[model samples]
Target: MVAVGYTLMCEQAGPKQLVDYAVRAEDAGFGLAVVSDHYYPWLESQGHSPYAWSLLGAVAQATSRIDLMTMVTCPTRRYHPAVVAQKAATMGLLSDGRFTLGLGSGENLNEHVVGAWPHVQERHEMLEEALQIIRPLLDGETLTYSGDHFEVPEAYLWDRPERPVPIALAASGPSSVDLAGEYADALINTEPDPHVIDLFDSAGGAGKPRYGQVAICYGPDEEQCRKIAHEQFRWFGLGWKVNADLPGPESFDSASSFVREEDVADSIPCGPDLEAHVAAFKRFVDAGFTHVAVVQVGDETQPRFLDWARDEFLPRLRQL
Candidate 1:
């Protein structure tokens, strides 16, 4: 069976909040911890985007059994892949070999904080060059190279992990997906749709497992949950005029004109209900997602999230 896990979108509140959540997640019966890795938030107005690697280091020292990962780490534009490899290797050591490296081509909005904007195609091209260097460096091999996109002469990891760390790549388009199968051990994606998984596999990941995450809100009241989810994810439904463009949650902008404020109610799960969550998760499972995570957050759910997981969601989900 694919073991159930707890995925944390770290609150960046403080030390106590971070420690307490990691502990509670472990106690709540999670077999894995998928954390987000980002240099900055999508919108500074949203809140703080704590340094993810620093937090992951703290998490490593705090927990023992739960497998740790940066749900997905973006290696292009912001931090050098060499730096990421070093941090990831150290964390893997601290976690006693329980950590995995998750990678991606990344988004311009997040990456542009340090560098200039690049189109989607250019971003993927950079990512390709990044992985080529990152994977070898992490393996603790001496490097000597000069490439159009990147270069390293006599560079290699000294404090590499106890064992080779598994590298997973995230991609949404055909070229990136094909490159993933050719160079990566696994795949990650925001949309947990199976069709995309099939596409990646056809390109190369024939025997690899795919991990995905979908957003949902849980609360004591269903209506309350929907309101919270819609406010956060309406951007997804907002982007495209047609619903088919987005089969998943995001802040998509739709409507030729001002969008009638989106109703989040249909987007997330709320209240003490179990049926809806079970049904919602099934969409991911049916799509061939072997490892899955539920993005459950918001003020109402964040503080008592573990309690809810232990008392509610897990009971219903484990049965499936």
Candidate 2:
């Protein structure tokens, strides 16, 4: 059976509320909790962006049984891979070996703050080098290196869990799929694309964990859910290349201004219909995802959704 999880969207709520939600998710019986590492919200109306690592420390202390991870963090720019390795190692210790580090090539929205965003190919190269540095360090080896994209001067993590934190890579295409298979311990993708999984499996990820995320807005009425999803998640309908290039919430808002409610609702499983939500998750599971994270788009219906998930959603998904 696929391990179901909840998303603690740092871009949607403040740290305190997220910590509270993390506890609630654990209480509601979610086995895993994934948090996004973002410096800005996709849309200004989405509102918050707290430092994900600091909030993660609090979440680790607040919950005991739930597995914790960054849905994805970009180590190529704002954070050096060495620093990310340290943070992941520390998080693994804090979570008592329950933390997985999810990484990616990253979007310009967050990375541009440190420097000019590199082109896609350079970004991939940087990520590849980052993985080389991070993977060994997490395994308790001191690393000192000179690479085209990064330089590490003999860094090591003193505080680490007994087991190495699993490194999960976010991949959406052939290149990234191969990178994940070559270097990462697991796979994460937002879409239910089986081709991505097939590539990863053949490229060395055969027995690894595969994670998928489903975006939805659950509410009392379908109309409300559609409105909420459009307001908060319309930017997601923008293709990855477009999503990765935008510099900030304003840029996203402008680019997504033309996105219709129907467009957003078409892709995301909105409303209170349990079957719609189940089918959305089923797509990923059928595509071979071993872990699925449900991203509840808006905050207004969190309590209701959590209640529904505990009583209705989870039991049905487990039956699959």
Please report, as a residue range, the 10-residue window in candidate 2 with the lowest summed lDDT: 297-306
Best by lDDT: 2
Model 2 lDDT per residue over 162-201, tens place: 8999999999888999999999999999999999999999
Error of 1 at 254 (Å): 12
Q: Give all candidates' CA lDDT scores.
A: 0.69, 0.93
Per-residue CA lDDT of model 1 for 1-320, tens digit only, reads 45566666653244456656777788887777888765443322234456678878888888888887887777766787777778888887889998888887665435657767566667677788888888887788777767676777668778877687878888766787898888888888767567779888898898886877766677777666666555444454442124212222222333312433245555555566678777777777877777777677563366676787888777777887
Give candidate 1 misplaced runs (Cα > 4 Å): 11-16, 43-45, 236-263
On the 0 to 100 scale, the lDDT of residue 111 in model 1 is: 64
Clashing residue pairs, candidate 2? none
Model 2 Cα displacement at 152 (Å)?
A: 1.1
How many residue pairs clash in model 1?
16
TM-score of 1: 0.88
Compute each candidate's TM-score over C-alphas.
Answer: 0.88, 0.99
